[model samples]
Target: MNPKDWSVSQTLMHAAKIYGEKEALFDLKRRMTYQELDTESGRLAAGLKELGVARGDRIGICLPNWNETVVLFFAAAKIGATLVPFNPMYRSHEIEYILENSKPHVLFISRAFEKQVSLSQAASLVHHVIAVRFKHKGMLSYSEIIDRNEKEMVREPIDVDEDVFCILYTSGTTGMPKGVMTVHRSVVQCAFTVSEEMHCNENDVFIVPAPLFHIFGITCNVMTAIASGARMILLEKYHPKTVLQLIEKEQVTVHQGVPTMFLKELDQEDFINYDLSTLRTGMVGAAPISPEQVQKIRKEMNFELCQSFGITETGSVTITRHDDDEKTITETVGRPLPGITVNIVDENRKPLPPGEVGEIAVYSFGNMKGYYQMPEKTREVLDDEGWFYTGDLGILDEKGNVRFVGRQKELIIRGGLNIYPQEIEAVLLKHPEISEAAVIGLPDDVLGERACAVIQLKPERSCTEDDIKQYVAERIATYKVPENILFSSEFPVTASGKIQKGKLKEQVLEHINA
Candidate 1:
């Protein structure tokens, strides 16, 4: 499939022709076939063109996970406009930054969230702000465009593989979010890789409980399912009960989410009562999962729990094969997917030996083009050799399986000792009382940096800081044990459900200095 030969809309058009009456998308309100999706997206695209949107223009989509949001994505693609998906959790400040940075030609928002957020407040940066609902005053309603526009316009012929498909902005942990430019080729390649590795088929129904703004949710869950002609069930929010209900009701065969999501679902009292026998493939990624957790998921959930590894920069990279032994599945992330290359290297860019920990780099068709408008930042990580330095540390075993240790930036340097938080965290999770844990590096006057462990314990289960430190000290070297331990009812988290270690580090340093 030549990605450059067709636009994202053309890809859908092709699918619609093949799948036609097959169910393509399902939400709480309605179920849409591939043909229905194609017609609606075409109408929306024509509507966008009437509003002065042209090729290469940026269109901001701020709606939640719904059938409309998916329609807008393909609609913008049909017109050769780049779809800029924003997190629905963003408030004014965050939305303001993205709108200003992208300078979108048209902003499509929902008036449903206007009670909590006002699109009128951000009217300065946007040329045209259209409301998906009628609650927001002084903006065109979504029906005004799609309902009235003619849906007979031809799909724009774009360099399907090379032209930018979507500009996904990163969640700004350090500063303002950077827009990641991904082409059609990258999206299609990633979808193909995920479908191939997971063995997704037309019969598979993918249940997506994650938010649509995230790349993992969009690429792995949305695009991958569409590429495979599989039905996708979209959830507005992730309630454990809702997820289980959807699985049983939809007969979902493939489920994908982060470890935290799986843990939360398991914690639900009614979790075991649900009829999830239809589920055959379960995938957890975006953050590290302990081998014990994987085992529990397999035993309790009764689904094959496969651990994969990837990031926003590189779409699905490595996946645990279904045929692998339990030990290999638990220990490594499996080999790189076909057409993907994994390399571990030191600071000097020299490839490291197997079993050595270093920065994990990847070369794949799924890699993002680069950071939008940030050439220096793009070049800093992506070298001339086509390798994207992941800023993550991992080791390749003798059999060429990759085991992620930690992120290089998150590595704690305590008195010249390098401690990976994931290692300590895995050990801490083994403790009976501990349900979740985050290890961070805190500033130390004498040692330069000290390790701190923040834990969220099981309800009513109590543990002191000394107990945690003692527990880790007995399992690992003394230097690797945390210098301080803190307990929290809840830890900060990212949109993708990973623990926000950076935020926890800030909280730890504030208390230690106080």
Candidate 2:
């Protein structure tokens, strides 16, 4: 497929043509061939049109990693609608926030979640809500939509290179989440880059353990599989037992997940009982992994564990190449793929030489247009020179491989989920007893890092850890709540009088461990 001329829909259609009879997607419930997926998605697109959806409209996808969710993604792309995939684990407040921000014309949701969380009552901006069910709902069912609409519709070819294919909202760590606008060309380039580095082929069966809402999961697993004519096995959620069973049952060839996920799976006592011989490649991203874990995985799982480094702003830009040495795969985030360039720059924006630590900047076709609706925030990171400053501090080795370092921002990774320190601090300051607050990330054994809140209470005002935790938990999502709280008389300050967060973090870690 011509990367410039093909839309994401066209890419799927072309895959359907070439591998029409081959299985395209699989779940515990059913297996869909490429031909079936194409027909089903086209029908869903026609149904969406009947319901007044048109080009450039925003469509919210709140379903789990099921066949219907995959179908809706392609259907939206088929009709040139921007897909806004929300995490199914989001509470009503989180869902409402995204609904208001994205302002989707329609929402596709599952009838019930694990705890019977319903979107029908909570979503205000959704004009129409379509429900998928294990049992029939009074409203329109997924099967009904496909059956009622025609199987084939005139696919108006879009300018694949220019059209915005998806608007993926980042998990808000600092404030309200920002929508990252990704174009078709960037998505395709990302898929091709991942597929090439992983040596994906038609015979490869990729297991998707990450949520489809995440860019890494969608682009690396779904789009890469479609572009390479490979098979995709979708699991609703990651359960170590289910994941192991599926891998052995389907003989999955490629596995992709975050570092936290792999850690959880490795901790399972029965992990060694599963037959994982068919697994040839595994990829971890979104968080850093220790060399100890990497060595253990290689010895136990018997597969090449490669790490991927990128963010939503720059779709998976660098990957540990398949043929890279164990040291390269473990120590660095391998070289940039074709058409992508990495630059390490100092405070003045001048490029630093190899082997020096500086801000990691990227110039790539895969970079997003900008943060949606935040020109000021967008300008702060994206420069006029086309380099996107990734707020990460890292060094380039003599061989041009980028090594993993710490982040410049106060973004915390808790079990692969981003927890912004500013967001937590803002919520903590709302307490009546708290006069000042600072949040930091403390290293953890299970999660890569956990949130730690350090606060100076109003003079003579007494508050306990429970009080502080409950105060923040009531305001934000549970994940954003600090796992540790420290009461301090005064925070350490630098010469400029700015609170020294590094020292505060160390203090918090010491206090917690003590």
By lDDT, the best candidate is 1
Name the lDDT value of residue 254 in candidate 2. Answer: 91
Q: Mind giving the per-residue lDDT tens digits that candidate 1 earns over 198-287? A: 888789999988778878888888888887889999987887788888889899999999998888888998887899999989678988
Deviating ranges (above 4 Å) for candidate 2: 1-5, 113-123, 134-138, 411-514
Error of 1 at 211 (Å): 1.7
1-514: candidate 2 lDDT, tens digit per residue:
4553578888889899999999999977899999999999999999888888888888988888898889888898899888988787776677777878788888877755434345446444677777686444455667778889976666767766567788888766557778888888788778877787788889999998878887887788899989889998998877878888888999999988876566557767899899999998878877655555566676688888787778888988777877888888877778887789999998887899998877889998888888877899899889897789998877898888888665767678899897756556656755778766788888888999888888888777999999888888889999988888888888875211235676777777778779
For model 2, give the 10-residue run with minimal summed lDDT.
493-502
Best by TM-score: 1
Residue 479 miss distance in model 2 (angstroms):
30
lDDT of 1 at 220: 86
